[model samples]
Target: MARRTGLPAVEVLDACESTNDEALRRARAGAPHGAAVAAVRQTLGRGRRGHVWVSPPGGLYLSVVLRPGVARECLRAVPVAAGLGALDACRALGAKAPRLKWPNDIVVLGPDGVRKLGGILVELCLGQRSAGAAGDAAVCGIGVNLTRPRGDGIRPKAVRDGMPAPLPAAYLDECGAPAAAGDYAAAATLFRDAIVRRVDAWAAGLWKDASAAPLAPVLEEYRSSLLGLGGTVLAVTPEGTVVGQGTFLSVDGTGRAVLALAGGGTLSLAPEQASLRPLAR
Candidate 1:
């Protein structure tokens, strides 16, 4: 663990079950905001909707504990702001044109196809107090494959359009990004600073009762950098059920995925409601 000015504390572990889990434990014990945890490898890394995240060595795995002073409704925008921060870190690490997959994924277009570069998982946890109380926090976990793992290669499984699809992972090193573990720790610091700025901007808007006005700038930049916008997509639940299929529109102010349905209606899905998959036109 190392302490840097303005960063508070960043605990880098040689190995852990999950950085998110570790950070959540610290948050429950009253760790202040901006506290972060990172690991060289995770034996039990997981993502949204109970999906497993293969956290081999040479990957950037980090989680930051956040305690933003905002109402419950305003929490929905946290992931949106965090995603932008992750995107900023990716670009800083030299990943060219990384597109944010709706909800919490960072991917890039390659000759093989659109492969994943990294992903984010935001989990809300109770603080030292009970639910709906003053003490509550969220863990924003970020995982980026910095270099190719030594093995048969990472072909992680995912659900796409009501079926299980195997994803061939993409590494940042493939795009000329830095791969040293020390660089990864620096990236984690970058992510923390980036997310804090965005969250503060959003909280200011909400405090003034300016509905969507504060998020306007964040949403604008997010939508433009989003992948597969204006293309066909399917929103599927974790149970492999197709909830909706439509043209992918912009992610709205509150971070809902706005889809233009095939039957002349629009559908808005929260991050937990579904995982989006692109479809061929």
Candidate 2:
């Protein structure tokens, strides 16, 4: 699609080990920058901490390959930018404006409360160029729900809010649905454009202008849409899980979320896990 539009074409896969994994392989093999890969289904979809992503049919699974020339330190913002991109994509689809949970989950409001809509996973690869010059590449994978889910053992609230009603399988039959192909295409375009724009801005040290704030507004937006702000929850990281009362404070200029813990230490997170549970009320 991108090639036809004079942009790089996104490689489409019917099924794959993982879109992110495939993208990383291609990047390591020296695929051109801006290349993308997408899969209809992922056989080994992974989430943060090796958790399996309940990937099945009727979802959008994709990845983008990036070989950026920016400083390594600045790469931390990629997930945040991708989250915002996903939110923008969903908005173009006419879904209720989706809210981003800190780090990388997209949430939507349902009868119960806010629930997940989609997620992103980023993987970085370290290697050397042809001249043996050290370099790095990253693959960003995304998964979005397009129709009713078919898995069991999912979070009840997440399953309920994330699934869409099934309709006729034909494209012609789906043109009128809320999450139609047109909407998906629009959302994908928005996401791609946002990534390109942000990458350019970050490279130029103008990310604040491109993002429209140093980071406060992004935090405010995320907090306003959070499902369990000011509640007790577990903030999980690769190191370990920290149980705390989370006060959604703000994100720093680099997109790190600042959380105030109940026992007195302030936790700044670019988290890998965020689960909400109600406090004794």
Error of 1 at 63 (Å): 0.7
TM-score of 1: 0.88
Report the C-alpha displacement of residue 109, candidate 1, in angstroms: 1.6
lDDT of 1 by residue, 108-158 (tens): 877767788878888987644335535778889888888888875443554
Judged by TM-score, which candidate is best? Answer: 1
TM-score of 2: 0.73
CA deviation > 4 Å runs, candidate 2? 1-5, 127-134, 151-177, 181-190, 206-234, 237-242, 263-265, 272-281
The root-mean-square deviation over C-alpha atoms between each candidate and the true structure, in angstroms, is 2.9, 6.4
Regions more than 4 Å wrong, model 1:
1-5, 127-134, 158-163, 179-182, 210-217
In angstroms, the error of model 2 at 106 is: 0.9
Residues 1-281, model 2: lDDT tens digits: 46544557666677898888888888888876567777777888886666667566666777876655544555665666567666656665566656665566666644444445677787877664453212766677777766654554222223321123111111111222364344444445455655554444444543334444334334445456555466554455443444456665555776656677777778776554443332333
- Against the true structure, what is each candidate's TM-score? 0.88, 0.73
